[model samples]
Target: MRLIKVDHIINFKLLGHGDDPLDTKKCHIDLNALRAREDAAIRRAEIEAERIGAGVTTEAQSIFDALSKTLPVRWESTVIVVLNEVRVSSPYKPENVVGGAGAANERVKKVLELERKRMQHGRQ
Candidate 1:
């Protein structure tokens, strides 16, 4: 039902009196086939994207798990691990680590200061 004009030329003609009905039917069939193919392609791309996302999440979790193991259980109460866990839930991904690393380091520095304050209060 949509009109597609190309360079001042109408590629398709409306079926009317004395016009060929078969040609119009053929165009409709071709358009439906093209749409079906496009939809299938879009679905495939979405599935692939989801698969990649799951792989990335799994890798990130592994890295965090290794980091956790490197430190003692008592250290889990530390600010660094808490902040890193927060970033794990963040929209930022490992691929963007180069740009995000600086900001993350800054946050760690701030968290370190807070930890120091908490320790001082605990001793009081």
Candidate 2:
């Protein structure tokens, strides 16, 4: 097997040199990007709290709200990291997995739309 190293723009680093596609390897994480994500989550949560007239003054609550967004697609960047790994490790190369790289993005969009309709109808 050939060693493959990937340096993702989103700060994901994967170094795999094995035969098994599913075999995991050490991943180098970017502290700066992680911190930025945390900061963004908190900021968005605060904005949502204000919009919904909810009192979310603590960092913990803010982070929680941000993780559970009304439109989860806003957090889809995190999901992309996993999909990228799958693509990189796969033996067969297809133009795209599941109809294209935007498959997850489209799925997230559909989920958000469904959530909106559910909320509008006062359904869970």
Q: Which of the numbered candidates is closest to the native, going by highest lDDT?
A: 1
Instruction: Determine which window of 10 residues in candidate 1 has minimal summed lDDT.
Output: 71-80
- TM, every model: 0.23, 0.26
What is the per-residue lDDT of model 2 for residues 1-124, given as tens digits with 9 covering 90 to 100?
Answer: 6555565344755797657655457456799999999999999998664433123333323322332453231112222112222221111112222332576545434543454454457643
lDDT of 1 by residue, 9-96 (tens): 8475778777576786555457888999999999999855432323244433434344334332112221114333333232223322
Task: Report how far residue 116 has shifted in candidate 1, in Å.
Answer: 38
Prediction 2 TM-score vs. true = 0.26
For model 2, give the RMSD to the true fold: 23.6
In order, candidate lDDTs are: 0.44, 0.40
Model 2: ten consecutive residues of lowest lDDT: 86-95
Clashes of 2: 0
Cα displacement (angstroms), candidate 1, residue 79, comes to: 22
